[model samples]
Target: MRRNVIGSVEQMTGLQVVEVNIDVTDLQLPEDDEQHPLHDGTRRVR
Candidate 1:
């Protein structure tokens, strides 16, 4: 994935890529959309 991203960027912009940084912060499951309050017109309680 990193290689693909870097290659695509370099090809599109014609710029050399020195490095790539990736950070994964969150993932949403298929069921999450149904259970998440915001999706169903309810505010999330803080």
Candidate 2:
């Protein structure tokens, strides 16, 4: 449902969608504490 809407918008705007990050995971976190605070909460689509 949401994906269809996104496709429609992209078609109308003719802009390239780099990525649509939706979910976050602990495994994506960095082992370093310094990097942890800088984490953007990004995750793979599938």
For each candidate in turn, the TM-score is 0.49, 0.32
Range of the 10 consecutive residues with the lowest summed lDDT in candidate 2: 21-30
lDDT of 2 at 36: 69
**Which stretches of model 2 miss by more than 4 angstroms?**
17-46
State the C-alpha lDDT per candidate.
0.79, 0.61
Tens digits of per-residue lDDT for model 1, 1-46: 7899899999999999999997756555677878876586554453
lDDT of 2 by residue, 1-46 (tens): 4587678778999987665655444454246644766556654355
How many angstroms is residue 17 displaced in model 1 relative to the true structure, after the best TM-score fit? 0.2
Clashing residue pairs, backbone N/CA/C < 3 A, model 1: none
TM-score of 1: 0.49
Candidate 2 accuracy as lDDT: 0.61
Which pairs of residues have clashing backbones in candidate 2?
Answer: none
